[model samples]
Target: MAGSVNQQQAVIYCRVSGAKQVREGDGLASQETRCREYAKYKGYCVLDVFTDDMTGKAASRPGMQSMLGYLHMNASKGSEIVVIIDDISRLARGLTAHLELRQSLAGAGGKLESPSIEFGEDSDSVLVENLLASVAQHQREKNGEQTSNRMKGRMMNGYSVFCAPVGYRYEKTAGHGKLLVRDEPAASIIRKAMEGFASGRFETMAEVKRYLESQPAFPNIDGSIRQQVVTDLFSRVLYAGYIEHEPWGITRRKGHHEALVSLETFERIQARKAERNLAPARTDINADFPLRGAVACADCDAPMTSCWSKSATGKRYPYFWCQTKTCGMYRKSIRAEKIDAAFAEVMHALSPAKGLVGLVKTMLHDAWGQRLAQANTIKETTKRDIAQLDKQLDGLLDRVVESDNPTVLW
Candidate 1:
């Protein structure tokens, strides 16, 4: 009877609430130790141990999954395998997961075992197990709710919660969990930009972009500060020493971190925004004359617009006209042919002379030759590295033949 009992092979399964718990505490290790002791008392041979460092509430766990796959393999046929756990809750947290995992193991022909509870065929035992699983799930959810409440309390006390914005970086202090700190050059640069805008030095966001482009330290995407980034930067209230996150019901609370600009300056910027918002939308220029604003009216020296005019015979024609009301040529159409011909003549005359073109080509060829020399140097360096790597590989292969360890060859 004892010899037959020793034939029963078992795999131990253990779980913790989180990976942190696994590292800080011996939750997984302790569970395995207890499970192995129980398996030994039952005259069982322990084949493997599976440890999960994640929530037991989920149906999926890496270790548990691997153990299941190994136990259910074709080679394990005709052998009675038991999945031994310290407790049923170690297998799962919620009632759903507990029942699901139980059924799954049964389908895989794995007998469930624990030091605490006996695997029963009766309905009462199953009901007790489900109740225990429900308790574990409730505990897990309660802990999560408390953690969220703590974070919300911290936010309500006026500490920044999310990842730091562009001009700021998150720092950990002795008293504070996490707080924002001004990140250099970028912070000073942003502060200067904000002050410039508020003081009317930068009239538009476009002007601010031009200022940023002139700066060597401004963060840019593909060597350019995006217009939308500049526009979005103007609306951040954190620059004014306040936080305004609406999701947590927070609105303009004073943050612990330093401000880039004063609240009054921020308000003035907002006023400028509101004032611009009230302006009437500009009508789009006619695509018939794409160069209306770009090309000046030759007669009045003002920008020219284009429109179609209908003759008495009902024939329509497009012509360029001036937009200035005070000018004598205002609304007076210039023949489209005349404007088109002038533009073409200007463009043609702007090309470099033949001698200057040859000089530019020579300069370009000299630059190309320098780049070619750099490429050849890089190629030689790459070839040397490859040759060294090949020698190392050959030496390792020779050692592997002499070494007894199969892993050396591998």
Candidate 2:
């Protein structure tokens, strides 16, 4: 009977909370070692070792599922396989998950065994197991809370603790552990794009997207810049040398990282965004109908829509039509050829006469001269404003230096 008991089959199960532990720590390996030692001490035949790198609170784990299937496959009428673990927490962090896995293992003909705790059918043993599982759950939750608090504190001190946005990467600094720094050509490209938008050079978000697409160094998904990314860039204050986290109650404050654009430019970008005209370029406009949106519907004054219509005899005809539901000519189609000829006639009608070319040139020269004078006046005004702001900033800095209380100013 002793020899038969010693010949019982067993499998080892080990787990860690995350992939970082699996890659950088020996938690899983050490757990497996301790479990194998226990199995050897019990004289059980070790069949396999299963490991999972995931949270214990998770109901289903790939390694756990595989071990269960293996146990069911090898189980015989009178033989049961022993499942060995280093500790109960390695099995599950929560009482509910522990109980569910316990039932599943028993159904698969696996007898639970651990080096740290002895498994028994008694009510007292089940109570101890449940208490330990609950403790493990509390520990997991506590750890999460501590980590969040630390990150929030770091962000409060003008350090970004979250993942770095595009054009920036994390680098280890002397005082700051991981700090955001400009990441090469992509940063330069983004700086130009943002400044262009802030200065009204790129009038619309569609123009910005096109500009980004034209840059060879800019990162792209499937060889195209996404509209959503452009939108996010416009609203992110971090690019303006400030940090803000509404969820953590961190208000806008100066960050330690170098800024790509000035706060003034960022504010201007926001002001322009309020106009609510940052619509993306329509993908439907193609070479087949170059004047689709350029030409207005005479009936409704809305841009005409273009499509190819198939006739009963299987012939395709390109046409432009008004799509405004409230218009009288809502679905009235105009032949593409007729519209093209009419547009050509209009262009001819509006063409400048040869005799008036010199007069038009002189008028443009005068307008250019006026613009130069206006720009000079604006430049002088901006200089005075900058000097006043500098004076105010100096006064604020003096106050910060005189104050000894940390909580008061912050």
- lDDT for each residue of candidate 2 in 1-410, tens digit (9 for 90 to 100): 13365498899999999999988999998998899888778898888999999999976999999999999998776778899999999999888899999999999999999989988989999888888889999998898999999999998999999888988999999988899998755676788889877765555778788888876557787679889989999999999999999998999999999998999989988987775542335333346776654777897786666678899999999888876678899889999999999989998889787878999889999977855665664567569889999999999999898989897587
Write down the TM-score of every candidate. 0.53, 0.64
Q: For model 1, how does the per-residue alpha-carbon lDDT over 1-410 read when each residue is reduced to its tens digit?
A: 23364377778888887878966898888888899899889888887878888887888789878877877882255665888999877888787888888888887768898989887889998778778888988877888889878877877787877668878888887777688887655777788788866754454566677777766556787667888888778898888888887776777888888898999989877876654421112233334555544667667774455667799999988787766667788777788878778889998889787799889999999977855764665567669989999999999888988899877766
The global C-alpha lDDT for each of the candidates, from Candidate 1 onward, is 0.76, 0.84
- lDDT, residue 58, model 1: 80
* Global lDDT of model 2: 0.84
Candidate 1 at 98: error in angstroms?
A: 2.0
Candidate 2 at residue 365, lDDT? 96
After superposing all C-alphas onto the true structure, candidate 1 shows an RMSD in angstroms of: 13.1
RMSD in order of candidates? 13.1, 18.2
Ten residues in a row with the worst lDDT in model 1? Answer: 277-286
How many Å off is the CA of 268 in candidate 2?
Answer: 2.6
Clashing pairs in 1: none
The per-candidate count of clashes, in order, stands at 0, 0
| Worst ten in a row by lDDT for model 2 | 277-286
